[model samples]
Target: MKNFKILNNYSIRSKLIIIYLFCVLIPMIVTNSIVYITIKSNEVREQRITMEHAIERVKYNLSSVLDDCVLVSNHLHNDITLNDFITRRYDNLLDYYERYNYLLQNNVINYYYNSQHVYQVTIYTDNDTISNSSNFRKLTSETRQSEWYRQFYNNNEDMTISVYYDDNRKNYGINNTARTISITRKLDNFDKTHENILKIDVDYNVILNDILNEKMEDNLYVCNKSYILFSNKKSNVGTEEFDTIDSIEEKDVKLNDFFRFKVANEAWNIIITANEVSPLSKIVERKEILFGLAIFNLLLPTIIIILVSHSIGYRVTLLGIYLGKVENEEFSTIEYNDGQDEIGKLIRSYNLMVLRIKELIEVVFKRDAEKQRLELAKKQAELKALQSQVNPHFMFNTLESIRMRSLIKGESETAEIIENLSALLRKTINWGEDYITIEDEMLFVENYLQIQKYRFGEKLTFSFYVMGDCKGIRIPKLSILSFVENACVHGIEEVSHNASINVSIFKYDSRLFIEISDTGSGMEEDQLNLIRDKLRNAEIDMLNNSKSTGVLNTYMRLQMYCNNNMQFEIDSKPKEGTDVTIQIFLDEPGVSNSFVKENQNNNF
Candidate 1:
């Protein structure tokens, strides 16, 4: 309930801001989160499907190559010339070479030409007559102990394919740098007494490009039962070993590292490893666009809410201000469109109430107006009487100064002091004006200070530093002189030693500054603070009760005259001195003029 009351205390604008965040922003964030998750899931599924299809295509292509190898092995096994050349013992190397040439031309050449993938064909036998060449070699104990030879010999299958370095290039005096897929098969004669090995090396590049040419964003490998047979990456062709996929129960399934597809007939499996590039690259590329959309979604509603709330709040505030005016008996009607909304209806009702109040008050106001005129005249008379009271006190002080000067100088400086007193009184009684230029006011202050100088003689000293440009600026009449009078009467008179007074007038930026400093008996901190508080609060009753009425009256009058644009400050330290500073902004000349006009209209 407490929280509810707190919420109710919030303005309509605050409520609308909260509503917009919950209703629009929260839902937008939730929807965006859900959409992002859905998109990511779909992308993952599509990537899996794509990987599976690529592996399947690789398996198909590899199977086709294995089938071709089987067909070639079958043709070589049935050929009588190749089988006879391998089984029969020749008498001489020349005769063996002739028979080997015939076998190569008739059968081996035909098989090599028919298959575009075949790199070389070789037949190795126990017969020594068959000389070692690129395509014919004599089988030995060293050849039987080789890795590819042992794999082929131990396998029970008819044909086996394994990746191996082509060592036959050594027989032809060339470096054996080519890696090839070797398809090996052991052939038996009719008596099963003689055996020979038939080997076909398929070009690894041709198999990869021509057979498994379906491009994928992943690495594809064709592995034998124990080791890799061929791979799109050359580094993994023969050096890498298979990860024991031969024992897996499922023929086509996904493994931890790769997607596996097996060809049981050839004991070969296709493994696909996904690359570093994700399949959702398109979505990642639009990251900036997604962020921009999110920001737009958040800001669009907030901007709309601010504009809408401002319209309603602004009119409501206007109504409040107008109501305050009515309560003060100003009787000003609110000026706005009579809209159809609730606030508009309230405004319309307020306008009707103001009209009725104005009409009802007119008759009574007329009678009160006459009575108020008489009362205003009486108040003006009383204000003049009150203002005249200051002059008597000032005149008595001047008379006392004249009397002191006459007794001290034996009437020699009396004439001069009396003339200065006359001039000061004339300036003070010129009450028709409330404002004068800075230059004219300084002249008046000089006259007053001059009379004081005659009374104090060398005991009181004063100086004025008025900037030429600031002399034309107008300020309240007698504002500066009041502070100077206070410095002489309250500050210098209380001290016995010679005291100095400094008055400066200058302009800084758009403001005019007047500083009056006195070296006299300064008040204590507590007394200074009390006066400062009264000046800041600007309480008329406090000013009436205070002994420093001249400073208080001057402060209040300047505040009214400048509409608080003027700044007044007092700085004093006990036994050190006191400084009074006044600053008036010159940006609005009408403020000073309006003060003079209002005071004149009031007959003060």
Candidate 2:
């Protein structure tokens, strides 16, 4: 309930955004994702099923071809003429040829010669009288050593399927050494005097082509335990030595699914494996349609929601902004001509309230301002009257006459003191200018210090130094002089020994630094702290509560002169000395004379 209340506090725009996200965006994304995943899963399953069916087709084609060779072998095994001819010993080559030619014409193997699947048929016997020929050969010691002969002779089965390389065929100038697949059987159907065997070499290319005719996307391997007999890949069928089943699998790492069946009493395998196909390839085909649907489902609804929400929320938000301005005392009317809704009525009511309050403020504010203006004028007249009491022209003329008389009396030191006093009075009494160059201010300070030097005699010493281009930089009039006056009055008056005051001015890092150090009776820690605190938090109101108004007044004036962009520091040790440092940023305005003058008069 609390969460719902907080949600209700949200603006109409926020609520609409939430609706777009959950109702439109999320459902659309989830629907598309489920569709994509279903399509991918089906594609993978179909690929697997297709590969399995292809393997079955390849196995059937392979079995059919081998069955043909098995049939041919069966006929030869049962043939009494083939059995009798090999068993009979031949007396000579001419007589053997006559018998061979006659048998060849009447042989059952002659029928298989024109068959496309059968390559050759040969009979081997141990009869020493029978010469080696194309169709019949006498088994020698080397023939006994051959792989196929040994397997057949040792096997207990009457018939066996074998795939082996016939290196002896290479001598027939058949330079292509294709591996041979043959069905070999012992011809013991009729008891014969000599041991006879019949072998049928099937056309390897014909079986391979049959497998290829299936046009399976996968590689197909037909293999026995000992060797791979044939493959859809023609190159795999023609090795001088048949490759092991393990070797074929190593080359075709993807060949995993296999079917095992007997071929002529020997176990054979048909392996089917597919090439890799990218899963995304099928998904990409439907992406454009899915994208279009998503735009219709999510984007279209989102755009509608935003437009409707903006129509409602925009005025509400604008009214809220105007309300905020009113909270800040900015009584302004709304410029938008909104509808006659509840919020529009509230705006109209607020505008009426603002107009009434503004009218009341104008009436009261003007009356009070007129009263303050009259009071300020009276204060200014009284201040000008007090300032008129001190006739600077008369004082200057008198000082000039005294200095000329001292010069005639040959009192050079007195004349110099009088001249310094006159210059100090002129600079101090001038109220028209609040700013003076560092050179003029330093000159005024020098004149004041000369008078102090005359008064203190040898007990006081002073030095003023200005460095860099700071001499022409402008500053508030008497900004440094007040602090110098305080240093002399409080720092030197109580000291017994010779005291020296030093003032140095310089500019660095675009800031003007004015430092004054005096070797005199410094204040105690408590007094120094009080003076430092007063300088830190100096304000026009402090002049009423503090006795050290001179230094505090100068500090505040300089602060206002520099737009409050200046720092002041005073370090003093009792019975040791005092140092006052002022750092002023040269970038700040220092020409606002009326600001300081008005505040100063108000304090007075």
Instruction: Please provide, for model 2 over 340-375, each residue's C-alpha lDDT reduced to its tens digit, 9 standing for 90 to 100.
Output: 555556668878888987997899878988999999
lDDT score for candidate 2 against the true structure: 0.75
Using all chains and alpha carbons, the TM-scores for the candidates as numbered come to: 0.38, 0.41
Question: Which digits, one per residue and each the tens of the lDDT, describe model 1 over residues 540-579?
Answer: 7976677769898999888887888888889998877899
Please list the C-alpha lDDT of all candidates, in the order they appear.
0.71, 0.75
Candidate 1 lands at a TM-score of 0.38
Candidate 2 lDDT score at position 17 = 82
Q: Considering every candidate listed, which one attains the maximal lDDT? A: 2
lDDT accuracy of residue 531 in candidate 1 = 87
Model 2 misplaced stretches (Cα beyond 4 Å): 1-36, 170-177, 233-237, 247-263, 275-277, 287-290, 293-604
Identify the runs in model 1 with alpha carbons over 4 angstroms from their true place. Answer: 1-32, 104-111, 165-177, 189-191, 210-212, 225-229, 232-266, 275-292, 296-604
